[model samples]
Target: MFNEEFHLEQPIRWGMVGGGRGSQIGYIHRCSAQRDHLFQFVAGAFDVDAARGKEFGQNIGIAADRCYPDYKTMFAEEAKREDGIQAVSIATPNFTHYEILKAALEAGLHAVCEKPLCFTAEQAEELLALAKKNNRIVGVTYGYTGAQMIHQARRMIEEGMLGEIRIINMQFAHGYHSAAVEANDQGTKWRVNPKTAGPSYVLGDVGTHALFLAETMVPNLHIEKLLCSRQSFVKSRAPLEDNAIVLIQYDNGAIGNLWASCVNAGSTHQQKIRVVGEKASIEWWDEHPNQIVFAEQGKPVQILDRGQGYLYQDDEAITCDRMGGGHAEGLFEAWANLYRRFATAMDRVNHGEQASDVMNEMWFPNITDGAQGVRFIENCVRSADEGSVWVEYK
Candidate 1:
């Protein structure tokens, strides 16, 4: 169970770049950051249009003067303030992430960025270097890993309950884009455009989420090589795949497969991961995030629920459970959990403490994880473009 009393003496003043009106992701970021009273929404460059951005900021109770027209202006003007924003969340298009995040770090502000941190691994590394040099925290939103059950799985695996891990299957397939919906949707439009979405569509978009989940659960496995096949089911979105499959060979001799698609007809967010070990296996589905299916080699299957006494209560991850057993908790809570960690990290830096000092006590996806996701996309695209042949994981 989460401790409601956990909070900072003063909430971290925060701002945003993008995620204006009608942006679902923007709204989610706001709700999650402010949910635990760890962060306070102080300002934003909410939209590309200056006038509309200022209006949206004021409409959401932010002062008119604080809402700048662009991130550059926001960073400049905020720096002069005694109560300037200490952190900012980058919720803009994928292509803009690297620049905005770079600017924020240079301004000495911590950041919470949407994933695939940048287009290339080189860019991701640059941002990582800058963050370290500036002593700022860069949080990548791999939101699902914050779920209490995920921590339980991690604890179980670490305890040797799963024995020698053999196979890992992961996927984040949905049917929302079975057709050319981007023809009518602006949000979806940018995603299918290489200029805005980066190298591979589904591979970087949904695939990274699933990949991070597997990484969080089985922390010991490292990809040795991989083979990838991708397709642009919606013809208009050529050069940007709407579906992709990746086969990974782990350094430990464990094999893994990832299926990421936006064309899984009739499905609704079928994001799942199943890890098989010599003695048992455990599976988790985002649709039913509260429970995990556990099957031992010789016993009947068992369903482990969140907040149950049987869970690894000693694990720090399990401490994120916001509600007791029967009540439901979903993406919002998971995101909030990540945000809370981000805040703690930022707060530590603010007090002249290293964010890594408390790593064993708390864990959150940092810049290194973000860089790895970008590299994974790079590898997948490399293999796919080279006639879908096996390639070394760089």
Candidate 2:
């Protein structure tokens, strides 16, 4: 238990799993976790290959004795140490999320996991159950919602700046997998295999991010129904969809469409969102993440840029941190916000600080958010398989 201070004066001791020599997502998680110097990497399992994992541990300057061969061993042994990791970040493949997250929860450590959380709704539910049982914090890396512009957008909606949302438009596109790569690229091979990537590829990969973005931006946004169409542009390129479009109906009567694809040539990641309301409309593009355009029915378009509150103060922009207006902050910066929020919340809990009324007002993607992503994917797949019919998403 911590003293009355309960301050984050020092970095939180942390560990990693599955971010070895060439892990893409793992590297991003590591970068984000350390961005604010709020976390100290003290241990890790690192890889499935024992030798490679050990090498990574040593290269990263982790104490040899603290390194372990498998996540099971790492979690178990770390829990025994007085200076063990307070949190663990999992960067393994999609299929392994449930198992690794469960292990971390079981060992009584907070976790930050890469998105989609798990492959199935059942697995997601189990993780949530376990998280609750152990009183541990579980954060999913839905980094899009972490963007400062997004926070500003959400604040605007909450404040009725955009009166009565009528239409919500979003799109997520990627062209990295436009052509087959499994034959020559071992690193991306898992993305093309069902056994490794799970049932739905594009829908689960980028769709979840869009879904979370839509939900996060709107106040109490609820999907009433959905209609989806999916196609395997490259039959052998990936086990599941390479492209899809989902039409969503919100309970508030606002309608929207979400287009996601991995085979759109030249589209590295062009995720964009636009919300049209009775009084005004707001649009934000991932490519131009630092700014948001707002326009009322008879008003001129207003462009909002990012900046820290201390220097260039804009109430909405203050929610989003920035070195300055022109100094760009992208994926890693957004992820840093998620990691910081998770650490702060967990830090409070670990100090025997009980959950307060203020804590309930806190924001960060958690196990519940993870489960909702799974729900969005499963429902979309079902709607697509059943001939793109209207599937109730209640």
Candidate 3:
């Protein structure tokens, strides 16, 4: 059991390994961490170029001495300080996750890293075991799972409010790469490059978020078999797939379909998931994140709004904002919620305690969830490469 009396006297000190100037994802990570008021950025290694890294750090108000040229130096020097960072955020590209994460854990610092834990399932599993050995908290940020309504859906499914889940339909579509930005833009070039983004670029980048959301909401279902097809619309601009589709069979006898496309001209940053059950069904979309369209077998569809008063499940209300009801709190708030919750758990672990059942179920996205995501990416690629032959999900 964890101590309720444990006091967090100060905001946890945190550092960053990436997200220097002109990096959109880096800005998002920094803003989200600050929004929660649970973390204070103290140090950083912001870019691959040492001069650029120092300049970026200085501009962001990180002291000249603490601004490091590389992640290795940041972790080492910070670990030596008495008031060193307790946690570090890895906002770098997909391929850099493994070494940075391992460094943080080995240095006795907690981590809140971006999704798709690593390039391979073996690396993901190794990182998970290392975190356990060090007794540290490792959080993978699945931003969409931070949404309040998503939690409500998870609770409803767990409580059997929606009978037995029968089908799942998920899609994440974007228009940014519809015309191939990689051909001209150097910043986004890594996304289409196998060396930086790993195999299955579309799936590994944005598609994995959809996979994690389904895994989080439908906890009882395990993927049994998968058949996938991946396509590259402009082969000259990008070698990796920009569009992909997947068909999944679950161990619990449910079926699922997933589609991811970067070439959808109008669907910019749109993501949605629909889970159907024997008695009722629920659907949610990021575009209109404040509501859930729920339907019963014979009853009319109910437009469920997110607020403390509108929730039947108490756990959902706990995630609601102080001044909610009509005011929209979307992406940044949701992401911050994940950070705050992760920090809370890290605080517990540092104080010599165990995370309660509620924390694991409702708050944290632990190592196991991240490992499964890596496995999903690996399995999906294998299935596609084998001529869409059904492959058993390991």
Candidate 4:
């Protein structure tokens, strides 16, 4: 058994590879890590650009001495410290994930990287092996998995409260289309650049969240085949696809549809998920993230709050119930919660102690999920390129 005593004294020391000034995702990652207070960021190489790296460090209150100019500097300097960073959060763009992550793991540091995991499946495989060989922990942030109420929804389904699941209808669309891809100069910059963004456009970014949610709630779920279509509605945008639609089938005969577009107007993150089961149906959405709407046959609709007195079979479900109702928790908090879990896992592994419930449930996304996500993006692009024929997932 792991010693609770050991876990308490040693907090996870952390650093950052990206997420410099004005970076949306990096800000989210920092807020999330701070929320739990389980991980203490001791150092960072916040930006790939030197000036921005220093300025970002100053802006975030990260000390100059600990804020290095590049990831290489951060790794080399910190690894020499007796109090070096135990982990590094990679908030860089998609393409940078693999190399930065590989270095971190090799240096005996754990990693909490933002998603789409890696740019390719092969990189994902190699990283997984490196992590195993080093006995290091890695987590990919699939935001929906950490959302408070999503846990309750997953638990209800797992406990058979919703009966055998049949189909999932998940739709997430936003009006950021033009704002994201057309905000020329700096607007459509890195995100639309193929060199930085790696592959598809809006779908690779937001669509992954939709896929992670569906995959998490359903049991024995393996994405069997997928049919996808892409669109460059703006036509002349550089770097990535601006819009896309994907059809997915799970191994157990369940089907799902996902659509993402950056050209669509007047939409403000309109997202919802509906799961139809033999016993009942449940619905949840980002707009009303606080509750999951559960409806059973011939019964009034029920709204379940976070952290209420509910029995949830999954660790994530229990996490939701513990947080309770009326306390609004969103993206940043969920991200923080994942970091807290990462701290727990790191403490277990670093101290050479036995694992706990958090480790057992594998609450955070790992190497396989990362690999799967890369394949997912590749297939989506391939299907779109090949005239939208269904593509098989390897």
lDDT, candidate 1, equals 0.92
- Candidate 4 wrongly placed segments (more than 4 Å): 1-7, 179-181, 185-188, 311-324, 353-360
TM-score of each: 0.98, 0.93, 0.94, 0.91
Clashing pairs in 2: none
Report the Cα lDDT for candidate 4: 0.76
Q: How many residue pairs clash per model?
A: 0, 0, 0, 7
lDDT of 4 by residue, 48-141 (tens): 6888788779777888899899898899999888988888899987778888889998988888887766777777788878888888888888
Model 3 lDDT per residue over 54-144, tens place: 9989988899999999999998898889999999999898889998999898988889888767888889889978988788888888887
Q: Rank the candidates by lDDT, best first.
A: 1, 3, 2, 4
The parts of candidate 3 lying over 4 Å away from their true place are: 1-7, 237-239, 316-318, 354-362
Give each model's whole-structure lDDT.
Answer: 0.92, 0.81, 0.82, 0.76
Best by lDDT: 1
lDDT of 2 by residue, 118-208 (tens): 8888888898788777778888898877788887788788889889999998889889888876678877788768888887888888888
What count of clashes does model 2 give? 0
**lDDT tens string, model 1, 145-238?**
8888988888888888889999999999999999999888999999999999999899888999999999999988999999999999889999
Q: What is the lDDT of residue 191 in candidate 1?
A: 94
Clashing pairs in 4: 32-336, 177-262, 194-239, 306-324, 307-320, 307-321, 307-324
